[model samples]
Target: MTSSTPQTLYRKIWDQHVVTTRDDGTALLWVDRHYAHEGSFHAFDQLAASGRKVRRPDLTVGVADHYVPTRDRAKGSAEPEIREMIRLLDANTAGSGIRLFGLDDPDQGIVHVVGPEQGLTQPGLLIVCGDSHTSTHGAFGCLAFGIGASEVAHVLATQTLWQKPAKTLRITVDGSLGPGVTAKDLILAIIAEVGADGAAGHVIEYAGSAITELSMEARMTVCNMSIEAGGRAGMIAPDETTIGWLKGRPAVPQGQAWDAAVAQWQTLKTDAGAEFDREVRIDGASIAPTVTWGVSPEHAEPVTGTVPDPAQAGDPGRAAAWEAALDYMGLAAGQALSDIRIDRVFIGSCTNARIEDLRSAARVLDGRTTVIPTMIVPGSSAVKRQAEDEGLDRVFTASGAEWLESGCSMCAATNGDMVPPGERCASTTNRNFRGRQGPGSRTHLMSPAMAAAAAVTGHITDVRRLGDVR
Candidate 1:
C-alpha cells in the first residue's frame, strides 16, 4: 500500500502504527512502548477494576519518578502518601510482571530521561506515558506523546489507543546558532514568536540546518517542551547523529541487527516537497540567550531586552493577560532583564539534565562560586555517575551548589523539593507557570549556562557578559 506521494516523517510513523480507523476519522494506534511512573497509579487502579491483566507486560516499564524523593531514598519519603505512591508502583509493576526501575535501581531516573538512556525509545516507534514530557522521546524521530489516565489504562489493557490525526507543522531553523545561544534559547524564542497555543491541534517537526547541527541531547531538550506550546508532540528526522548516539545502548539492536536497523532508519527522513499543514522559518543567528520574565514560557525575551509593557500589546485580550502575568511575577514593565535578582537556582529536569547540560553549567561555574543558593539534580543515575566521573560534580560542589541525587527534583516540586514562598528562582526546567515550583514561587526559565550565570551573580546575568571563566 506504499504510495509515491511525498510524506513527512511524522506521517510515515503515524501511518505505520494505525491498527484501525473509525468512520469519524479517529484511528486506533498500536502502542509500541509504554512507560509508567508513580502518577500512573490511577491507571493501574482502573485496569484492576476492569479485571484485565496487562496484554503485553514486556512492552511496559514502570519508573518511580515524580513522587520519588531525590534525597535519602533508603529511608523513603517523609510524607506517608508519597511513600505509598512509590510502593504502589512497585506492587503494580511487580504484580503485572512488568520491569520496574525502582528508586534503588541503578538505572532509576525520570521516565523521559531513562527511556532514551535505556534505548527503549527508538525511531519510528509509537511511545506514550501518563507524564506530559513523553514528547521528549520524539527526539529520535518517533511519534511519541503524553496520554491521560484513562488512555493509559486502555493501553495497559489493550496496548492500543484511539486518537485523532493532528495537522503537521514543519518548523525549520536555518543557519548556525551564534555563540551563547542554545536549544533552550531557540525553543523559548519560537514559543514567544508563536504564542503559547500557536501550535494547538498540531504536531511539530523540527528541521533544517540548525536543527540538524544540534546534538541528540539538544534535540531532546527542544522536543521535551513541545507540550508547553500546546502541541500534540514534536519530532526530528533521524540521521547520523541519532544513530551514533543509539549505537551501543543496552536495549537497542546489536551486531548485524544494528546494521539493519540503521539502514531502515536512514529512510525515515521526510520526502522533498512534502506538504505540511503549516510552516515556520527561524533564523538561528538571530536567536539570543533567552529567558522567561513573566509566568508563561511565551513571556520570553532576550537577556539584553527589557520586560514587555502590557499596554503596548496590540490586542486587548493579550494585553489583559500580560497585565495579570506581570502582576503575578512581580515585575515592572520596561525594566531591564538583567536587573532581576534571583533568590535561588535549579539546574535539572528532563529538559536540561543530561551530561552535556551539566558540562555547560560546569564550564560557567569553573572558578566562580554561586552568590545565591543553588541545587543540581541529575536526570538519571547514569548521568550522575558520568558527571562525577568527569568531575562536573566537583565543579558544581566547588561553586557552592548542592549536588543531589537524580530524579525530577524541584522541577515539579512534588517530592518535597520546593522553593520557599515568594522566592524567585532561576531554573533550567521547562515552564514558568505560576506556582510551578511551589506555591507563591516565581520561576524564571533559562538555559543551564544562563542559570549558572544567575547563580554566580545573584541576578539574571547573561552568560556572554561574564568576561572570562578561566
Candidate 2:
C-alpha cells in the first residue's frame, strides 16, 4: 500500500521523478528543467569529453546572466572573454538544439528572472541551475536548487541526477507585518534568528498567515534567499495567488491544458494532517525593518538597534567576526543605525527588482531628492518597458535616482557598476559579504523601499516614517 502520510510539495515531486530507490535509501531523480548560465560552459565541456550530447535539449534553457556586463551589452562584443563565452553558449545551445534566450532577446535578462517571467517555472517540477539562486524558482512550488559544475555535466548528459531525500522544515510566520515591512525584512529576520547555517540539509516550506498574504513577487524574494540560510530548497505551496500569476504566460499551459494543470497544482499543498521533520514559528509583527551589519545575511539587526559591540557578543569567534565586519564597514560599536550614513543607494537585483518593488521605492522617493547617488535597475527589459509605460521611471528619475537598463547591475561588481572603493551603499541585492559589491565597498542590504528611504535620508532610516504603506 502507498504511504498515507501527507507529504510536502517537494516530497511529492521527488517521488514522482524517482527512477529507483537504492539499498541506502537514496533515489535517482529525473530533472524536469535544467537552467544554465554562461558559467555553465565547464559543464558542457565535461559532457563533450565524455562523448555525451545533452539528452533533453527541449527541457534545457540557457542564458547569459552572471559574468555578463549589465552596464554595456556592447561590452559583450568588445571583450574577448565575454564575447567568446556568449558565442560558446550560442554554439552549444544551437548544437544541442536547446532553447536559448540570447543577450539581444527581449525576453533575456538574469536567468532566474527570465525563467519565471517566461512562465517556464511551474509547480511540481524539478529544476536545477548552475547558480545558487536557483532557489528563486521555488516560489512557483518547484523543487529547485543549485548544483556543482560536475553535477551540471551529469544533468546535461543524462537529464537525471542522483540524490538523497532531504527532511522538511516548516517556517510559519503568523500575524500581520507592520507598515513598511517587506518579505526581504522578514527573511532577513528569519536568518538572524536561525543564523546562516540553521537550515542546513533541510528543504524548507514557508507558510502561515503573513506569507499567504504576500504577493507573488514578495514570495519570490523570500524564497530567493533560502540559500543564505543554508536550506537545500525553499517553497510555498501553489495557491490561487500563484495560479493568478500564471494565467497567460507563454510557457504556461493554455485552455483545457491550463485547467488540467491547475487541477494538478491544486493538490500541491500540505495535507491537513501533514507533519514536518522540524517546525519554526515567527511572529511577523515583532520583526522590524532589518539590515545586515556584517558580511553574512544572518548578521542583521533591527533598524532601531545600534551596531553590535564585539565585546558584548556571547561567542568569542562571533565577536571576532563582528570586529572584522565593523572594521571593514568603518562603523564603530554602539553607533546608531541612523548615524551610519550611506553614499550610494542601489535598488535592483534578482532579489528585489520586480515591478512592485519599483513601485514601493518610487512611493518612498516621490517629491524627494536623493541625498546620494541612487540607481534603479529593473529586473528585465519587460519590467523596464512596463515601468516606463506607467511613468514609474520618470518618478525615479525625477527623484534624482538614475534609471538603469535591465540586468544584474550593481548586484555584484562583475557588471562594471561597482560602488567606488570605501563607499557605503544601501543596496537591495542579496549578499553583503566582504567585497560582494566591489573591493573595499560596503553593502547594507534592505528592501527597495528601505533603500529608497535611505537614499533620501543618507542613512538607514525606518521606512515607516516616510508615509502610508498602502
Candidate 3:
C-alpha cells in the first residue's frame, strides 16, 4: 500500500475533517454534529463569559436528559438545582439559536439515542458531545466521541476542535451468536477478553460477519460501550444496512442528495489489506450470555461461570480489586453466579432500551410475573409510545415491572431511581461502577433478556434455560 493512500476507515474520516494542523501536531477538526445535554451548561457558560454564541447553531442541539426525572416526571418535579439546570439548557439553547429538546419535547431523550434516531448521525460525520456515550453514534460509520466541557466551549466558539488522531484497532467477531446471546453479551465478552482499557488511545472499528449482519440498533448497543474499553470511539463501515436505516428517518438528506450521499457512503469501508495498528478476533458462537461478576465492565464472564478467586488475579492490583469488589458485592470466591439472588432488575438504558431490546425482554416474560421489583425505562418518549402501540409496555406491566417515562433512570441515581443500598440488581446499563446506581448499590451488568429472567426468578438465571427464545 502507498503511504499516500488512507490506511483505514478512521484515517479516511479524520483526513477529510481536519481543518488545519497545529504546531503541536494536533489538528483543528471540523465537527459535523454537536450534541449536548444539561451537563453542557458549563461550556455554554464559558461561551457566555467570552461574549460568544454557538458558531454553528444549526449543527448543535441541547437536551435535558440526565437531569430530568423518569417517574411521574413533570419538568417541575425535580429539585431546585436540577430544575434550574434543565431551565438553563432551555434558556441557553434559545439564546444561542440552537434547538433544545426540553422535557416536554416529544423528541426529548438521551442525547446518544436521539441523535441516531433523528438521522443526525450519519456516515463520515465528525460528532462530539459532552456525554461519553456519544460514541454510540459511531455505529452509523461516523467518527464520534466525547469531549470535555472545555473542548465543548471551544467547539461552541468555533465549529472545530483541536485533537490528535487516535491509532486504529479492529475487533472482529465471526459467526452467529448462540441462543439467548445478544450484542450486549458479545460486547461484554469482548471486554472480558481485552480488559477494560484494552483499546486505550485507539479508535476501534468493528467488523466480521456477525457484526455487519446485526441490525443497526444492535450495532449501536455494541458501539455505545466502546468507551468502556477505553476506545476513543467505535465504528462500523456504512453499507446497505446503514443506508436503509436512515432512509426514512427524520432530518436525513433527501432526493438526489440522498442518492449522492449513499454513493459516497458505499466507499467508506476499509480498503482491502489496509493496515490497522492492532486487531482482535473472537468466535461469536463461543460467546454465551455474559454478565459482570465484579464492578468493572471487564470483570464479566459467562453466566454459567463461577466468581473469580482473588488469588487467580495474578497481580497485586487486580487481586486487591477483586477482593474489594467481592466484598462490596457480597460475593464469595468460587461462587456460582446463578446462585446469586437479586432484589431488583433494570431493563432499560441507552444500551438496551430500544424497541428491539424491550421486545426481547418482554418475550421472556410472556405469561410470567416478577419475583422482584423490576423497572422499565424507555430510551426515548418515541420508543415509549411505540412500545405501547405494540403492547410491549403491557408485557412489562403485566410481569409486575414498573413502566416509566424516558430518561437515564436506574442507569444513574441522578434522577432518584436509586437501588437500595446493600441490595443487588441486574441492570442493563453500561457501567457497573461502585455506587453507580446509588450509594452502596450493587449492579450486575447483563442483557435485557437476562435482566428479565433474573426479575422473575430473583436470581441470575440464564435466559436460555428458561424456555425457547423468541
Candidate 4:
C-alpha cells in the first residue's frame, strides 16, 4: 500500500507555475508578475544586449522608489544620476507599452506597498523583484523572492525563471498578542529566537491562530522580514482576511470574475498533516515589544530587557562578536535597553509604513512632544494622502516630527536621507546592519510605537512606559 503525499500551499503554488522540469534538478517556472525599480537599469541593459523585448510587459511593472528623493520629488531630482534613472524608467516602460509608476504617479509608492494596493500582488502568483523585500508580496498568498540583476533580465526576456524548489518551514504563533505587542514585535522576537540564518535554504509559511487573526497589513509586515530570517521567501495562505482586502481593489477581478477568483483563493491553504521540512512554534501573547540593539535582525530583544552582556557569551567567538557589536554601537554591556540614547528617529519602511503602523505611532505620541528630531515617511503617496485625510500628519508634525512624502525615505538613506556620523537612531525599518542608514550610523530596529517612544524620550524606550513619560 502506498501512502498519499500531503499537499501544502507552497507545493500547490509551485506546481501551478511549473512550465518544465529538467534532469538537473532545475525547473522553468512561469513568473506571474514582476516589479522593478531604478536598480533594474542593468537588467534592461542586459535585455537590450540580448536584442530581446520584454516577453510580457503586461505582467511587469516599474516604480521609481529606490533613488527618488522622498522630500522634493515634484521639482525633479537635483542629482543627475537620479534624474537619469527616473527618466530611463519612463522611457523604457513607455517604449515597451508597460505601465510605469514614476515619481509623480498617483499610484507611486514603495514598490512592495504599491503592488498589494494596486491588486497586482495576488494569491498563487509567482512574483519577483530586484529588491530583497519582494518577500513582502508573500503576505498576499503568493510566492515572491528577490532575484539578481541577471535573473531580472532573464525573467523580463522570457517571463519565466529557472529555479529549484525550496524546503518548507512553518512557524505557528498562537494566542493573542500582549499589550503593546505588534506584528513587528512578533517578527523581531522570532528572528532573535531563530537567529539570522535559522530559516536559511527554505521558504517560510507563517500560520496559526494569531497569524490568521492578524490584519492583512500586519501579515505583510511579518512576511516582509522573511528574507531577514534567511528564508528564500515567506508566505501566508490567503483566507477571508485576504479576500476581503482584495475584493474592491481596482486591480482585482470584479463581478462574476471576482467571485470566481476568490473561490480559487479560498483553497490556497496547507492541508492538514501536510509535512514540512521544519516547524517552529511561538506564543504570541508572551511576546513583549522587541527592539534590535545590535547589528542584525537576530540581534533583537524585548525593549524591557537589558543590553546583552558579552561576558555571558558562551564561547570566545560569540563573546568577540558581542563585544564588537557593543563597541560599534557605542554601547556598553549590561546597560538597560530603555536607557540607550538616540539622536534621531525614523518611522517609515516597507516593514512598518502602512496606515495601521502610522496610527500606532501616532497613538503613542498623542498630546506628547518629541525630545529629538523625528521623521515620519509614509510608504506611498496614497498612504500620505490617507494620513492627511485622517489628520495624522497634523498630529505627527505638531509633535515635532517631519511629515515627508513617501519613497523608502531614511529606510536605507538611498535618496539623500542620512544619519550623521556617531549618531544613534531608533528606526522602524528592518535591518540594523552597520552603516545601513548612512555612514557611521547606529540603527536600533523597533516597532513604530517603540520608535515614537524613543522620539519622545530621546532614548530607546518601551512604549508601555509612555504613561511614565507622560
In model 1, what are the clashing residue pairs, if there are any?
A: none
Which digits, one per residue and each the tens of the lDDT, describe model 3 over residues 10-30? Answer: 988998998899888799899
Best by lDDT: 1
TM-score of 4: 0.97
**Cα lDDT of model 4 by residue, 1-470, tens digit:** 12366778899898899899999868999999999888898999999998999999999999878777877667877888778888888888887788888998987999999999989899989999999999999999999999999999999999999998899999999998877889999999999988889998899999999899899999999999999999999999998889888878878888998888888888888989899999999999889989998888898999888988988878998789888898999998888998899999999999999999999999988788999999998998889999889999989988999998888878878887888888999999988999999989999999999999999899988888776322
Candidate number with the higher lDDT (1 or 3): 1
Cα lDDT of all candidates, in order? 0.93, 0.88, 0.90, 0.90
Lowest lDDT block of 10, candidate 3? 70-79
Between 2 and 3, whose lDDT is larger?
A: 3
C-alpha RMSD for every candidate: 1.1, 1.5, 1.3, 1.7
Give the CA lDDT, 0 to 100, for residue 198 in model 2. 91
Off by over 4 Å in 1: 468-470
Model 3, stretches more than 4 Å misplaced?
1-6
* TM-score, predicted candidate 3 vs. hidden true structure: 0.98
Better of 1 and 2 by lDDT: 1
